[model samples]
Target: MSVEVLSFGCRLNAYESGAMRELAVGAGHAGTVLVNTCAVTAEAEKQAAQAIRRLARERPGVSVVVTGCAAQIAPARWSALPGVARVIGNADKLKPEAWALDAAPAPVSDIMAARGVAAYPVADFANRARALIEVQQGCNHRCTFCVIPYGRGPSRSAPVGAVVAQVRAALEAGCQEVVLTGVDIASYGPDLPGAPTLGQMARRLLALVPELPRLRLSSIDPAAIDDDLWRLLGNEPRLMPHLHLSLQHGHDLLLKRMKRRHSRADALAVAARARRLRPGIALGADLIAGFPTEGEAEFAATLDLVGEAGLQFLHVFPYSARPGTPAARMPQLPMAVRRERAARLRAAGAERAQQFYAARMGEEEAVLLEHPDRGHTEHFCPVRLAAPAGARGQVLRARVTGADARGLLAEAA
Candidate 1:
């Protein structure tokens, strides 16, 4: 079987797909591939469907398996689609070996952390410059809008020691940077014996690997950051200064309806503190434009607050309630309304992003040289340089040449 895996949705899906690929190869069906499914939104469903059709056209009757949030939510829908030989829910992931086309993998008697921690593969991905290590999986918080916790099993955290081991392994494998990812990364280490928080995990990792080149964090819940975390992050050069905070709504009333723990003031306080503690820090945010009963006044307040928050890059997405969540029962804005709101927020975000890039025109920022092909700036701005291939790993002080429709350009300073 000629196996090729396609993943959709969050980093957890990537981790699960990676593990599935590893086990399939070990089962003597080395060539067989897996098609991972995603279910973040309705758009994700359409994309997964299109991908399935493309895979079926390429190789008919291959052992195509679909799994993840999409499959979990609507297995019959995916199973009915062409080219998918099997559909596995979260329960099926309990034993990845069983899904193999032929022979099952031998159970490992002695394992690190727990037996299922490595349920997903983490091998043969040496080509990428950045590796995302999913430190935890699943979410416990019942955020009214999210479907992830239901899609994944009860919240599970990889062992802290196991996570550190993975980090060390990725570093040894020549990865330039490691991004700690998960559905709810702030809830990391909760399922383990000790239940250390994300801040503690980060502190421990920084202490353990004193010389690790770069440590990047995925978006974190504002409620999770504490005084200890801010203090630890203040002088840590290895820890990336860029922080992506998820602030879905700006109104305290809307936040309450969304079931988020933090209030509007709470989020603003965290962002303000992070900026004050770290000067010239790049702060990013994820904002939802339209949710149930989010009137024009509420939306306007959100826009006002976003500007006041001093956000650099904003990922503005309109709300879509998934089934099995509390928000689905709530009155939904029409598709036209959703689309219109999304467009307005997106336009605002683009203007803000342009301003941010423009401000960095004369400043010298550390560029983590990704590859001869493409790379990203520390602030998540896309960058391309006139430098040579040797500039892959070295941090180059690049002078911003220009910011076009595509991205910012730089010359070696």
Candidate 2:
């Protein structure tokens, strides 16, 4: 008779899921299952649908409430799913009244008309060691291959004071690390008064909540990185030395087709700048393996960029065309070709990751323990302690002892 939440997609969605669970449980919606879905790809939507059906079969009488990008974009479609009692939109999902026992069903409003990011303060992240704060919401740019804007609405930023308060709350709750996340985090300021950039917000947050030990950012668009953020990367020791860029493709032509603002050269330069500012910074990127009209040479360019950009952690996805995206109407690559290319890109990334881990041997790293024996370094590299390090959420300094396919082996320093 307890409420449960199932989340898919980005860290932002995961953060929202935490808020949704609180709202549902607070409203006495016991025995309900909240499904926070993703709509990043056609495959993602299909998988969510499959999971929903499975949940219905396994838990016969549990009321299933669906929300998130998938539900927001197509409310009727998700509402029509089996065992679904209600389908809330992203706009209404976090509101306290939405989960009320007598609240109206399918309370989806116009997401595009939404403005301002509300501070959804979460005390803890269930079992997570790091807390995620949504500093921004939605996207202003319409990438040819993306449908997130329609699901998440326009770009809006949480006020600096709210961000600081959230970080302070997380620190008080014993979270050692906090990650600032959003849909297009780099597009964080335009809608706000005075238009304070992401860097300015982060700087202010750190200054206000000085006890916050570590600060990290989710994926950021390379083309929009503000100067203040770059300065923070160079000077702020608390800011983790990990940068994950939203560099979808490495070929200029493919990037242009995707309507990405940054060129391949721009991505490379950003990577270079990060390394220069924060030496030995671990870099990560999101690279699509096969987009519509991607040729063998174009795929090779991306494969090569992994090495050139020194990306140690990679999130590689084979292109899954959304039905209404501009990419869907272009000359599409075969599914097999897409999958094969994705595999190859993954292999290249894996090799580079191994090399990066090897280079970290004997270096001292402050590890934030998510479990008694496992944690992640400031570089965001996973570490397994030779023996128990400490309790979850404890930050301990460790020296890298060895490297394995999974990550690094460490000993408390």
Candidate 3:
């Protein structure tokens, strides 16, 4: 094993893992394992720690370097763990010099003080049908429940030229789709000169790279939708009509407590506008089931918002308190309560998703084949091809024949 990166977290982390692999191999480190951890929830942290212990025991002598959000936030904890050779912070992961075999055990700096965004140019994602481009890094917001700010530091965006070049590289590498991802994509360009918005970046990228077949954006804050993005939804044919919103809760008070910028009305309006512009667009969201100080009514409002917002794909997270966050200091909910509410929310989301897939039955869609026999439609709905659809990474049109709890069943049309 030359280099293997165990990535945990968002699409941004997955993209970075590729860069880490490249950096590790280039640094002459073979049989090395890098664990990229997440700091989003306590469970995520626990899993990372467990993996580290397991790797040490099973692999014995392979170098185990911990990096990413979890490592950045608490380097001492990971450094103390046995068999951990080195701990790299989020700020230094992409730097080639940082991975030097003879370097110190742990080299972490003040993440909040870091300002510049470094470009990690990945030629292609290993065996991925689509490529992901990290347009920006870090978040500026101090959401009471989020530890990402500390883990990732301040928001910084890559220059427009660098982003365009990355997309060009992805396209030239035979990738059909490219996804623009970041910590807070909506907060892009604020730290740079001229203050370009994410919408502007998307337009520039699409206009400059016409050969690019499809483009998608990862989770975006509801409060950050600008006029330019709305125009893309209304006009850009190549831009996929699917968006995953970063809406933490439904009730205004709970959202306020979470320090989220968008309200219930704002979320509803954004979903409505997206559909109005692009008919039959799929709207997905990230919703937390139980937050600190959340009452029964607050949780109920979140369940109702799924219908009111017309959300089709729901990423439900049961709130897990992280140390040093404002929410963690507040009155807490029982562990059982959080898990129960999460299940209920997931059930509701499943019902809505089945309805959405059922409605697509008999319609023709251009599905991007991620697997020989499976693919995802333009709306991001999963489809199982009736026959092998050529090869992986080929996009083909298929007629939806039926719907199941999993997704749509399609045959070559």
TM-score list, all predictions: 0.90, 0.98, 0.98
TM-score of 3: 0.98
lDDT of each: 0.73, 0.91, 0.89
Per-residue lDDT of 77-131 in model 1, one digit per residue for the tens? 8887887667766545546456556633232221112222443437655655667
Writing each residue's lDDT as its tens digit, candidate 3 over 172-287 gives 77788999999999888877788889999899889999999999999999999888988998999999999999998999999999998988999999999999999999999999
Question: lDDT tens digits, residues 1-413, model 2?
Answer: 77888889999999998888888888888889889999998888888899889988997877899999989999999998899999988888878878899997756899998888867798655566899999899998989989899999998999998888888888777789999999989888777889899999888888888888899999999999999999999999999999999999999999999999999889899999999999999999999988999999999999999999989999999998887889889998999999999999999989999999999999998999999999999999999999997998999999999999999999999
Against the true structure, whose lDDT is highest? 2
Q: In model 1, what lDDT does residue 400 have? A: 86
Please report, as a residue range, the 10-residue window in candidate 2 with the lowest summed lDDT: 118-127
Off by over 4 Å in 3: none
After superposition, which runs of candidate 2 have C-alpha atoms over 4 Å from their true positions?
none
In lDDT terms, how accurate is model 3? 0.89
Task: List all candidate RMSDs to the true structure.
Answer: 3.7, 1.0, 1.1
